[model samples]
Target chain A: MGMLIIIDQPPYGTWAGREALDMAFALAAFDQPTSLLFTGAGVNWLRKAQDTADIEQKSLEKNLAAAPIFGIEAILADRTACQRYNLNSEAMIDGVQLTNASADLLGQYSQTAFAG
Target chain B: MNQLHTLHILNKTPDHPRFSECLGTLGPDDAVALTENGVLGLVASKALGLVQTYALESDLSARGLSDDNLEAATIDYSELVNLTLQAERVISW
Candidate 1:
């Protein structure tokens, strides 16, 4: 009912998707309805077994696990994008709903912003 | 002016996967606006001739690209927002 934040970049390579996640968090914090859509390479952010301990970065999996608690509306992943990356529902962090990031999906939101 | 279907605001470099993905989603009535590193698409893609494309003038200038020889038009910041206003939807890739 508010805005859709699209993440099309893969995690860890650049901070774009991560920053987009921050924006989503901030939006949630302010009680602004926000949802996240992971498309293209951004689908990688949904993978469940990311071990970033060596990379010394915050785990997106862990971060996303806390998304709903922060009041985020939805955690959406593009079906095609997830299929291309070979991520099934079991391999993804829980609570992710698969949907096409089509014009219809975007039309539901008042704003759609891309991250990186 | 006719209402455009979607305005693709791309800022990725040509080599980025999203760059190709963005181009692939273009419809006949869609437009593309290249900004930031996406301006490099003006050099990388000679195949955008069919689409109504625009590059941010400052971004193109910053990259040493002149729209005079390019297939797309160049617009200023205000015109960029106007282009967004003119379109039915926008996808910032």
Candidate 2:
């Protein structure tokens, strides 16, 4: 893989996670291989049924649903983090693959970056 | 602008790992400029005195934090910009 962008922060609190998502899509637009690993509080991004209207923000759930369409390779959530956030397959959006979020997982990519 | 070798601009809250990660990399010539939620670090620890720390005055006031009794010097946006310009290496964490 060309690069792995690790998103460790939860959505909406800051622009970091959203900026990272945009970076991933920008890379995909150029046909660069990009994967995203949602670990720590970032696993909240994959949880389904986010209602962002009250927050006056775009729904990241809706945005993430378009990842595959953008040619972004994979959406990996840390298994432990998922459990901590109580996000089971049923509670999360479709197409998210769970992994250990280990150092070995990071080694698969030649380059790795933490999302802002 | 201070004569610093490196300037670290941090915006993460104290609870975030990047906060300490930024602190861990500080060299003798390096200084840290805290902005956004990073200004909260001043309330989180006194050990932050180890580094030459500067907190964004605007952010601190917005968060209802008073830097008068805090360990960090309060700076404005222009000073933060100058810090980035002055340092040979700059990192935003």
The fnat scores of all predictions, in order, read: 0.00, 0.00
lDDT of 2: 0.80
TM-scores for chain A, candidates in order? Answer: 0.96, 0.97
Q: Each candidate's chain B TM-score?
A: 0.93, 0.90
TM-scores for every candidate against the unseen true structure: 0.57, 0.57
Q: Write the per-residue lDDT of candidate 2 for residues A8-74, one digit (tens) a residue.
A: 8766658999999999999999999999999876886786666554335787888888989999999
Q: List where candidate 1 sits over 4 angstroms from the true fold.
A: B1-93
DockQ of each: 0.02, 0.03
The second chain of candidate 2 has a TM-score of: 0.90
lDDT of 1 by residue, A1-116 (tens): 79899998766647888889889999999999999999876776776666555345776778878889999999999998777655677767788899998999999999999996
Q: Model 1: which residue pairs collide?
A: none
Error of 2 at A8 (Å): 0.5
Per-candidate total of colliding backbone pairs: 0, 0
Fnat for model 2?
0.00
